[model samples]
Target: MALIHCPSCAKRISDKAPFCPHCQFARTDDPESLERAARIRQIKHNQSLMTHSFIALFAFVGGFALWWWGGEAADGWRAPAGIGLMSAGFVGYLITRVRIVLAKRSKG
Candidate 1:
């Protein structure tokens, strides 16, 4: 049998499979169902991206606050720790934003 993609989860499966092993979706000839499943998966992925971006923003802001709270001095642990957090958060936020844009662009 040839390999086919599961309509529900988009995983590879045997064409002769009676049901999708990954998602337990029964084999069907309905195009609408496949479209609906794809939309749902995309929505979930977008939500996850948003959540990650929010967390990154929170980290960045918290780092900035910590840096200022420590009197903006370079001779303390707070300075280095805050800088590290800020860098990580900034990078993470940028990556997430790019992924969001790409995901939106890929909508079919």
Candidate 2:
């Protein structure tokens, strides 16, 4: 087997080894393996963004429903609570949008 430098730990390792002995980083010089790893990372990032968007939508809708329904109730706190929930949802959406933009910028 030939010796090569580990990409993660920068240590010498056997080219045939599946992982680095020092840092346990997966060793794959194949173009397909590199592409697959990049794809997986992208998929995971997209999934996270989707989750954040869903949560934001749910919170905003739930808050609006609460505000509408709470109007019939005599509680003075209901309106404020609903507004707070909606604001939180708005903040989450803004955060998600910023993160997506930053990711695209970094990629470019």
Candidate 3:
């Protein structure tokens, strides 16, 4: 069997190992391993961003639509709703941006 690094125990374990013999870390080794682990982490992070982006896009669309409808709906309450939706989109964007910045900083 080939040798591989254990991210958990920081030990070199056998590629076929079900668990690290020295540190007892399980499912931490396998064939087709290193690339798979990196792909999994990247997919998870992308899913998180996509979810936020979807919500933000919906909010932005809703805000614009409401702003247009406000003129048609008497009393202009739709304008307020539109403003709220736009604000929500802005807040979501800011949160996402901050998270990205924090993640970058943490890497260094």
**Worst 10-residue lDDT window, candidate 2:** 70-79
1-108 per-residue lDDT for model 3 (tens digits): 799876445578888988778756566435566556555655566568768877887897788777777456424677688888988987887787677667557646
TM per candidate: 0.81, 0.66, 0.55
lDDT of 2 by residue, 1-108 (tens): 899876665679998999989977797778776666666666678779879988997898877777779356425787888888888988888888788788778767
**Top model number, lDDT:** 1
lDDT of 1 by residue, 83-103 (tens): 988888999999999999999
Give the best candidate by TM-score.
1
Worst 10 residues of 1 by lDDT: 66-75
Cα shift from native, residue 31, model 2 (Å):
2.5
Candidates 2 and 3 compared: the better one by lDDT is: 2
lDDT at 32 for candidate 1?
A: 89
TM-score for predicted model 3 compared with the true structure: 0.55
- lDDT against the true structure, per candidate, is 0.86, 0.78, 0.71
- lDDT score, candidate 2, position 71: 59
Candidate 1 lDDT score relative to the true structure? 0.86
> Candidate order by TM-score, highest to lowest?
1, 2, 3
